[model samples]
Target chain A: MTNEIARPLFATALRLTRNRDDAEDLVQEALYRGFRSLSTFRKGSRFRAWMFRILHNVFINRVRRQQLAPRATDPADLAPSDHDHPIPDLRDIRELPEVADRHFDERVKAAVDSLPDAFRVPMVLFSLGALSYQEIADALEIPIGTVMSRLHRARRHLRTELADYAREHGLAPDPHAPEGAGS
Target chain B: MKCVEFRAQLFPYLDGELDEAATGTAAAHVADCADCAGRTAFERALEKRLQTALLADVGALDSVALVAAARRSPPLDSPTPASAVSSGVSSSSTGTSSSTRTGRPGHVLRFLTARRLLAVAAALLIAVQAAWFFCIPPFECSYLQAVERTVDAEGTPLRPGVVGPPLAERIEVTPEVLGYRLEGEATVVDLGLGETANSAVRARYAQNGEVVHVVWSDMGGAEPSFRRKREFDGRSWWVATENGHNLVAWMCPVTESLCTLVSELPEERLLDVADKLRAAER
Candidate 1:
């Protein structure tokens, strides 16, 4: 029972945390917390989704804390360094978009990984879970406006990246490439 | 409105998030404006194409595992201030209510999955159970081979004793039921013996699967409690319990497909509980 619930959620954490050991540790902790607070959970709703959201929240908070931490000044007192450091910057994400399309799966996976958290999440929610913007807002605890803006930027970013991808790979024009008179 | 403003508000316009007045203006502008339509079409196309590149990549993300891990290392739990989990969401009645409301699924699964969850919860439950029946050895009952149930145990069944001890040099789990999975020169402490064996299985019987049943041995073998199936919810789940371990089996017919699935073996749960206890003890 727990395995079915934890496996997919664990997989999500692995993608987010990107450290296998950290991912495993995070999974264990989530189950402990989830079970401890089990009384608060609702019935008939999706358990995996609920817990997955919790795990995502937990991972995001850690990232935010690290981002907020004093880098050089606090290296001594800082959190343990992880092997899979997050792509905290937008520029880096834009550079690595799609990994040159050598392998379709690898290409796409790299593209998603390249996106910043703001864009990566709604993208995951909409693309992965098919959640609407409002639903995305609910899942991530962000406002409706923020959700819209992030999604908008994500689309634009993906378009800009994929356009370069098409040009470089000798692929056809992006179906999204601006048509006549739109620009 | 110019195409510029329309382009800026395209997503909101598509989602109809704009005010009623702005909505009217955007619609009027789009109908008369080919350029805006083209851009609108472009943005829409961008979203669609991105979706295609992205949708397949989405599930490729192991979301469940990630979330599960996140749940474990909650920054909120890391000796931080209480207000941390609420960092993004301001303290409000609505937000609190939503979080509280969202808590329902976990509760319900906890309730409905009572038996199965308990049976399979030990960290080693699946592994030990799998090991006990097919992967490892001893305590594997012959009766269980014919019975296959699709059951899952969530969480863990074992309480921690000691954790982080190295695995004994000769300690290993063998894949043979009715044979000691733990190899030679292993010090095993029985949890259910005398004072330690205070914990008991909480069984809720079902109406099905009463044809052939097994039970636990208590009351000096005359009153066997762990090795029997009790009636529950219009069915009888095969009940098998060891000293400190508990295993139950029940089958639910798939409405679309008619097939029977049985739960795990007798000592599987106990083995999980015991394995965890041992690991923690180490």
Candidate 2:
């Protein structure tokens, strides 16, 4: 029973947190919560969706807590350091063909990570979880149309990101290629 | 259909959810229109790459500890918040109910204490029962214990007898060490996305010399609980009767494989053949 969610839960958490240790912790915490709340789950309900919902809820709560926490700041923290003059941007590095080739996957992953949860959650669930739009809507408690629209928007964003990467490598048609339109 | 319409339907058509006529029409349009063809190809390539990147990055999952953690906890429903029950009771009672509602915080504290006691009791009960189940040795564990149930047979011929058509042009097997022989091309079956195991590989060889059903996946596959007995190579294999049909499933940690061999042959022969097939590659 628990085995069915072990890898997927971890993988989903990993994607959400982008850290292996954090992912494992998130998965374990969600599993414990899901186990406790098992009775609340309707019979014949999708266990995957339920488990994922718990996982997503836990993730969102953690994010909220982190956001609400007050950070202790020293006066020096407000001051800019000479060593922090400027970090080279990945977009700048991506202009080189070999750099783009080596970094495209990372760039795509970073792009995915950068998406706001509204678009990221549904997109990841569809692509990685193999969930249908209805299932995604159920899991996220959103309207089916919202799920579809978010997926469309998310895919478009991913394509644009990949297209930019391709352009960097001279693999795309044009740098100014029109962003394809969809619902 | 216009190229715009065709492009709009590309996702559904690629997903194979389009009506047959629409699919045919879309295919015809793509055949004639280079732009649509390019877009469709790009979408397909993107999906493929996304899948590859996702799976490749899943990394290692420690399943045993996860299963143990799940097995330890009792269902959380018994400890419903006192406020909920009291609120329901108050709703049915008189004006004095308002006073009772005011006491909810205290009621909740008491309830929490009681719930803690109940949880401890339940945990103790669970431990005793779990020990008994394990002592018996042939308990029906959850279906998840049987993971990774298919072979990656891309370009590999499944049927030993049939020479013409092959099973699958693309094979994605989990655990990566499963093998089987099919009796005929007709034995190959379509695997729907819903039916396949998560992050696992599965294929049905409806016919070989004898029918061989194999499913190989990681521990992250879902199914209902069934009678199962653990077995060889530090994994659990179940040979149980489901709906009056004999089903044999194996989860081998040694080789990271889960295989199910189904046959009309007697149990002894079936086990023998399974053993041979399991040991074939290793």
Candidate 3:
């Protein structure tokens, strides 16, 4: 059970931290905290979601502490603010082409890693296919609508980022080129 | 559905979270409208690519080590004062002070009272007994013991129960009972000593380097308790992992006995085998 649960936690941690060492540390701390609070877990509930919630909280706390520790001398830095990123409407997601089935592994990773945390968390959790939208909402303590919105926006960002790759493979038409340019 | 409605439901539709009515409507819209279909295909492809990239190369973790570390760490509800002490120690180690502080003993000499000494001795005795009980060989639990016996004696001829008819005749399990050919015969496990030995039959199965042991016991109401309850193929099975082996226990409706399937396979595969056994029973 621990091994089965650890794999997803580790994957999510790796995505969040973007460093193997930090991911391991983050997972280790979350697991420790999870065990200590294991008594609070209700039976017959989704155990993976419960663990993900703990991992989410641990990661958020660690980020906040790291952000605060270096700027301890400034009182204004202690205020909490929503970590929302302004996403520009670059291209109609419908106009974007299908990503080639092969050899875009690194680019996809970079695209996902580059998303802001607010959008990235839901996208990563959704892509895992381990949790439903409701479960993701519960894990992150957000409304289900928010989860869907963030996921849609995140995909839009990814499509914009990968659109260039799609054009290079001739899978999508180049928007900047004039009509009949390729012919 | 209009394009606006389809767009609103696109993500949910792709995720399979939409209700049946909404799903049908979305499907119809995508089927008829080339633009919506293209967008749906694009989203599906992107999601697949993202899933593939994110899950790839997530190296294996040493679960045993992680579990050990979790056990060693302090509880979540530890007192705040403990943090102060820990921080002090950390600061001292990193600071420029090489000198260590030693506590001075109190002027008053207090010795352990007779009652306290006796209590200490009693605690030590109990600890020793526990250590001996767990550390002693052959102290394996009955379920694990049956697993070990079946795996160790693979390909051996079937053995009869000491006091009953042949073990194979007592249980209806066969090599192909689980929809596949297992490689071993059934053996009766003595649940007690001598004439009172309540017997249970265990059959071993191996395929593609995966081993499974199916044990049927008539020990009424002796079903092993597991925290996770899973419903597969319209029957409930109790699932648990013990000593790195997966165990699925369910009551066989046909034999009217508790049946346990044990294996080193992943839980999903083990559950598949259990479902097959259930189907055979019916």
Candidate 4:
């Protein structure tokens, strides 16, 4: 069962650290701690959520001990907008010709990596489909509303980052409109 | 639903987190409004692309390496401080101490003053006394001596009783058969019988407030001196009591190992356990 979790756990770690060696170290430490505390795991509970929670805690603790800069994005800034607006122009990415190109993947990764830890964590957990909004909230010790707001802003940031790529590929309708205009 | 309501529910609707009513209303709004339909399609495509990018090259991690690292890690429940764990991991990985990582002094100098030396002497004296009081095993002259050491007997006074004969049917003695669950892993204990120091496999079982210990060992031709003996099903069992504890010893027919069961249970229950304990492969 843990074998199945390795890939997604590594993927999440990589997204968080943005460095291969750090990601590997983070995963190894989390898995070690998880195995040692296996006795505390309650039966019939979601193992994915449990493991993800450990990984999240380990990453956060490491960041704190290193005294890295605090989260770049503020929670208030990530709040969902009250007014209605048109969505950003994002064409069906798979239908685009660049979808088959390796550059497309790199572009998406770079855009995701650009997000601050505050927004990036929820985005990675949600995009992995390993957790729900409630599970993300529980893992990050944030409210569900905060989870939703960060996810919304994370995607908004990614759309802005990739707007040039979308326009270059003719995926967007307006060529002259500024990127992230609707957002 | 209006465009405002559809926008509010858009992320949840796409994530399959919306209730039926909200999902249905969002779907209706998207169907009527071309712009809402495009936005929904764009969001779905964006999520799909994000998942693909995030999961790409996840096969790079070595599962075997990860498991090995985990196996090498110390138990989190140990008496070690939590900071020590992080420090240990860092030192193992980077060849550095906690002081190096945190830029703080890791050790302090201490002078053994007269008061400190006296305190150390007092601590050593107390430790020696505690060990003599608790670590010494009870002495028994008979073959029960070996059994006592196997059970780590504290010389509890056994009660005097005559246990009845075993039944004709012989079954293996297992936690399942005795309706008890094994508490933990079975441990190999040294019997310290003679020069050779024979070892026995001891397994403990508990149910509710009662606990039973079963020990299996090769007695090396030692015979029980207990007066009470019973024969049934082509085997004989020696039953004896020391202080308050009851013990039943018999040669297992299947494994040919001397199986001894010790508990504070009544004589009848001990015999019944002996009966059920025989005849199966060990």
- Give lDDT tens digits, candidate 2, residues A140-166: 777776676666666666766776777
Best of the candidates, DockQ = 3
lDDT by residue for model 2 over B73-97, one digit each (tens)? Answer: 2223442324444443221111122
DockQ comparisons of all candidates to the true complex: 0.09, 0.07, 0.14, 0.12
Give the per-residue Cα lDDT of candidate 1 at B210: 21
Off by over 4 Å in 4: A69-87, A92-94, A97-100, A169-183, B31-35, B65-282
What is residue B19's positional error in candidate 1, in angstroms?
5.8
Model 3 chain B: which ten-residue window has the lowest total lDDT?
B89-98
- What is candidate 3's DockQ? 0.14
lDDT of 1 by residue, B96-182 (tens): 221222243243443344333333344444453344324235332232122122111232322222111111111121222222121
**Candidate 2, position B12, lDDT:** 63
Candidate 3: list runs displaced more than 4 Å: A68-103, A168-171, A175-183, B31-39, B62-282
- TM-score of each model, paired residue for residue: 0.37, 0.47, 0.49, 0.51
Please give the ranking of all candidate structures by TM-score, highest first, separated by commas.
4, 3, 2, 1
State which docking tier applies to candidate 4.
incorrect
Ranking by lDDT: 4, 3, 2, 1
Candidate 2: chain B TM-score against the reference chain B: 0.30
lDDT of 3 by residue, A1-183 (tens): 334456667878777767655565567667555544544555335455667788877777656644422233333223232134222222333343334434566677778788777778787776652567888898777788778777767776776667666666665555233211110
lDDT of 3 at B69: 32
CA-only RMSD, every prediction: 22.4, 17.0, 14.5, 20.5
